[model samples]
Target chain A: MAVFTRGFGGHHPEADRPLPPGQHLTADFPVLSAGPTPNVDAARWELTVRTESGAEHRWDWAGLQAMPAEDVTVDIHCVTRWSKHDTRWRGVPVDAFFEDVETAADFVVAHSYGGYTTNVPLDDLLDGRAWVAYEYEGDPLEPVHGGPVRLLVPHLYFWKSAKWLRGLTLHEHDEPGFWEQNGYHLYGDPWSEQRYS
Target chain B: MNTWHVAQVVAVGRLTSTARTLTLAVPGFAGAVAGQHVDLRLTAPDGYQAVRSYSLARVGRDEVVELAVDRVDDGEVSTYLVDVAEVGDRMEVRGPLGGFFVWHPDDVGPVQLVAGGSGVVPLAAMVRARATSGSPAPFRLLCSVRSPADAFWADELSAPDGVATTWVYTREAPPGVTRPVGRLSAADVDAHVIPPGERARVFVCGPTGFVESAAALLLDAGHDPARIRTERFGGT
Candidate 1:
C-alpha cells in the first residue's frame, strides 16, 4: 500500500511561472554529471555534424564565433526536479549551423568531449529551439557548467543539453544516449514530465 | 530499472545536527554499487510530491537500502527526510541510478575520495564496501566540513579501518589538531590524497563550489582529469 508521511506537507513556494509537474524552483543551479568535467580549450574546440548520408559539416572555434549569435533568456528544468528561471545564455543557434547542411535524418545524438551522449529529435534542434551556448550570465561558461560550449535545449530536461558538446550525428532512427541508455527518458519533455523511460 | 519501488523506513539514526540516516526496506532491490544514488519521492496527504536524489550510504545485494540526508536550509525534501521522517514512514525510490560514478570491488586501483560536508555519505559507502569485500585497494579520504560537529559518521571515520582518513575543518577544529581551520587548499589535497604518480582514481562530491575547487586542485596537482569523477549537489 502506498503510504504518505504524516506532517509532511510539501514546501513549494508560489512561483510566478507555473513549474512543470513534479518540479520545484531552485535559485541555485545544480550540476549533475556522470564523470569528471572535460576541460576543452576554445582554441582547439570543434563541432561536427555528421549526417546519415555520411557527410560531415565541421566548424572550428573561430568559425563558430563568426556565425551570428543570439542572446537568450530561458528557464531550464532538470529531471532531478530543480528548475531555474530566466537563465541567460549566448550561442549560435543550431539552425545557423545547419543552414547550408543537408540532412534527411530525423534524429540527432549529441556527443560530448567526455564521451557523454544524449539523443534529441532533429526538429527540436531547428526552429530556434536550441543553441551551442558558450556563455552564461554574460560570462564565459565555466567547465563545470559545460564550458567552453554545451548544447542548450531549454524545452527538454536539462540532461538533453549535453555538456562539453563536441559533435552531433544525424540518425535515420532514434538512438538512446548515455542517460537514456541507463534510465533517463529519450526526447525528454518537461511539460509532460517525461523524466524516466 | 526506472520503475519506482515502495520503500518503508525501517530504521533511523542521527548522524549530526543537520544530517540523519534512513534505512529503507526496498523489496526486489538487487543492490547498488558504491557511489550510486537513488531518487527518493515523498508524497503528502494532499497528493503533493517532492523528489530528491541522495547518494547511497550503504550498498549490497540485499533488500535493505540506507541513505544519509543533510538538511538544506529551506529544502522541502531534505527537511522531511532529516527531521520529520521516522520508522514506519514510507516513500518511493527509483535507482540504483548512475553508472559512471560507481566503484566495483573487482576494479583494481588506489581510490582517492574527496568530500565536502554531506558529500561524505557515498564515499563512506565505498569505505564500508572495501572493508566488507576484503578489497586490498588503498583508500584515502579527505573530508572537508564546517567544524568537528558538522562531520557525518564521526565515530566510524575517526577510527581508521584500512582507509587513511584526514579531516580538514573549515570553520573550527577540535583541540590538539595542527591543521589550521580554513577552507581546503591545494596543499591539503597534496599532503592527504594519493599523488598523481600513483594514478589513483579520484571521486569528489559535495556542493558545486567545493567540487569545482577540489577538482581544480587535483588537476593542478597533476592528477589525470579523466580519472577524477565528481558529483556536485546544489547549494553553497
Candidate 2:
C-alpha cells in the first residue's frame, strides 16, 4: 500500500489530453542518456541489420536518404514519467529496412554509436510502428537529441528508441539491453506503466 | 528487484531559496552507495500519484536517507518537496538506482566530479562517503551554479575537506571573487579539472545542456570517453 503524502495535491493533466499512468505532460523534450553524446558524421554513418541466420543488410547515410521517407507526428512517453504529445519526426520506417530480409527471430537488439543498446520485439518494428528518425520538428536532429539517426518506436517507452543508432541484431531469445540490464523494464510499454522490472 | 518502501520524512532543512533537504527514515532499508538515486512517489488524498527521481545526498545503512531537491519552475513534485511537504510526510521510495554513475570508496585513481546546479547532490554524497570511510583516493569537485546563493551545501563545500573544490558562477560570484561571472568555458575546465594524462575517473552530472557542454569540454581536453561518466537531467 502506498502512503498518502499530506499537502501533496499532484499536478493534474488536462482532461482532454489523457496520459499514461504515472506520466505527466511536459512541453519540453528532455534528453536522458547514460554517457557522453557520440559525434556521428552523416557521411560515415551506417546502419546494419543482422538476422539470426547471420545474414546482414546494410545502409549507409546516402542509402538511407534514398529510401522512401515519412513525416510522422506521434506521442512519445519516456519511462522517466514525462510524455510529450504530437512530436514531429521524419524517417524511414523500420519495416522498409526489413522488407527484403528474412528473419525467424522474435526480438531485436538495437545498437547505438555510444555503446548504448535497447531491446524490442520484432513485431513492434513493423506495420508503421517504428522508424529510424533523422529529423525532428522539420530540422536535422541535433546530436544532443540523437543526431545522424535514431530508432523511433513510439509505442514503447522512449528508451526503446535507441539514440545514435548503429545496427540491429535479431535474436530468437529476448536479451535485455543497457537500461533493461540496469533495472528498467525489458519490454517497456507506457500505457501499461511497465516502467521497472 | 524494485520494491517500494514506505519512508517518513524525519527532518527537512533549507538548502537555498529553491532547494531543500529531506531526511527520511525507512525500516529495513539496506544502505545505498554514493551517487545512486531513488524514485520517490507521492500519493495525494485522492490516490493520484506522482513520482520523481532524486539523487541520494547521503548514503549508508543507517535506515535514514537524505534527498536534496531543487524546485524547477512550475514543477509539481519539486514544489511540494521544496515547500509544502513537512517532516511527518510519508512517501514511497524505490531504489538506490543506476549503478553506472555510482562512486565506491575502494575505487582507485583520482576521481573528478563535475556538477551543475542541483546535480551536486550525489557528488556531495560521494564526498561525505569518502570522508567517512577515510578513503585515500584523491577527489576533486567542480561545481557550476547561477550564483553563490544558488550553490547547494555552500558552506560545507566552501570549507576545506579532503576534496579540492572549484566554483563557476554563471550569474553572480562572491564579494571577493576575482573570476568573472559567466557560463563555464573550456578554459575553466582546463584550468580546474584534472588533466587527462592522470586518468582520473570523471563523473559529470547536470542539466542536459550543462552535461553536454561539460562532457564536450572534457573530451576536447583529451579525456578518455570511457573514463568519463555522465548523468543528465533534462532541461535547457
Candidate 3:
C-alpha cells in the first residue's frame, strides 16, 4: 500500500510533542472496573446493528473477518484540549461493517463497554473516512484500548468513536454521550475549537 | 498550542510516602499567572511517553517551576510521578499553560476558588502567587477534600489572614475545624458566590462530578455561567 504524508496517526515530521499515552493510563482507574481481555474464541464476539427502522441484527466475529480492512492515521483531538497528532490504526472497512445491516442510516450512536456511548450524524460515518478499527499502531489492538473491534470516525471528537465498541444503533435524532449530554458541544471539531458547552 | 521548552528537574522531594513535588527550572520558563498549569511529559524506558498536566503549586520567580502531584490509586502517569520519577530528571515540559483558569497579577476581582481533592493544586498556586505578588484581589478559597488526610495543600489554601478560606469535607470531619462538614450544597455555592457579586470571577477545579455538580449548584444559585470558569484534571 502507498503511504500518504498527511494521514491521521501517520508520522508528523515536525510536531515533536510527547507521543500518545498508549493503550491505557500506565495506572488503573480505581473508580471503573478493569477492561475485558480478548481471547481466541471468535464466537464470543458479536457485532450488532440497530437500523433506523427499528430492526436489530447481530454479526459474529467470523462474519466481520470476511470483509476488507483499511488503515487510518488521523490526528486525535480530545475535548480536554490535548491534541495528539498522527496516530496510526488499521481496521475493518466501513462498507464491510455495514454490509449485513439493512441500511447505513443518517444517524448512528456507538455503544460500548463501561456504559459509554457517543452519537454522530449518519452522513459522517460513511463520508469516506470512517472504519471499524481492529488494529492500532500496526498490531492487534490490546483490549484496554478497544482491541479486536472499534469504530474509527476521525471527523468528530475522539469520544464520539466509542472504544470496546459492541454495536451501532441508528437513530433519527442525535443522542449525546455521557459528556455531550452534560452540556458539551454538539459537533466537537478540533479546528473549530469547541472545547466546552 | 504546540510550543514547548525543555526544562530540567532541579529538585524533587516527597510530600508524603505517596506524593512528591518535582521542581523544574526552565532558564526563562515563562512565569505562570497563578491559576495556569504545566504539562509534564515523561519518557518511559520503552521509548513511549505519557503526558500529564499538573497545576503549578507555586508561581513567580526566585525558584524553579514546581508542581505538587499526589499518587492517584489507578492513575498511569500519577503513579510514575509519585513512585518512579526522581530529582534531576530532564523531560520535555510545556506551559505555564491554560488561559481560562489564569490569575494574573493585575486581576483584582473578588476572586473565589472552589476546588476538590487534588484540584487544590492550581488554586493553591493562585493563592501562593497572589500572596507573593500582593495582588490583594479579595481572594477566597473553598477547598474540599475527602478528609484532612487527603487535603493536597491544606496549609496554604486556608491561610487565616487577609485571604478568606473555607475547607469543605465530604466524608469524615475533625473536631473544632470551623469548616463545613459535608459536600458543597446549593446553599454553600450561593453563600460564597452571591456576596462576591458579579465582579468576582469564580474559579472551579476538581474531579468531574465535583466541578460539574458544584458549577451547576453555583449557576442554580444565580452566578453567571460566563463568570464561573472550570478546569478538570482527567477526561471526566
Highest DockQ: which candidate? Answer: 2
After superposing all C-alphas onto the true structure, candidate 2 shows an RMSD in angstroms of 1.6
lDDT of model 3 at position B116: 82
- Report how closely model 1 matches the true complex, as a DockQ value: 0.62
**Candidate 3, residue B166: lDDT:** 76
Query: For residues B1-236, could you state the per-residue lDDT of candidate 2 as single tens digits?
Result: 27888999999999999999999998756769999888889999999888888999989766787999999888889999999989888998887777778899998679999999999999999998888889999889999999988999877876785689999999999899888999989889889999999999999999999999999999999998888888888754
List DockQ, one per candidate, in order.
Answer: 0.62, 0.73, 0.04
User: Candidate 2 residues A49-136, lDDT tens each?
Assistant: 9999999999999999999999999999998788898999999999999999898999999999989999999999999999999999
lDDT of each: 0.89, 0.90, 0.66
For candidate 1, write residues B1-236 as lDDT tens digits.
Answer: 67788899999998888888899999978669999988888889988788888999989858788999989898888998888898988898888888777788897699999999999999999988988899989889999999999999877876755689999999999999998899999889879999999999999999888998898889888998889888888843
Candidate 1 per-residue C-alpha lDDT over A1-197 given as tens digits, one digit per residue, 9 for 90 to 100 = 55676768987587998999878888877898866677799999999999899898999989988999999999999988889999999999999988878888999999999899999999999999999999999999988889999999999999999999899999999999999997778879999989878
Reference-based lDDT, residue A4, model 3: 16
Sorted on lDDT, highest at the top, how do the candidates line up?
2, 1, 3
Q: Could you give me the TM-score of model 3 versus the true structure?
A: 0.58
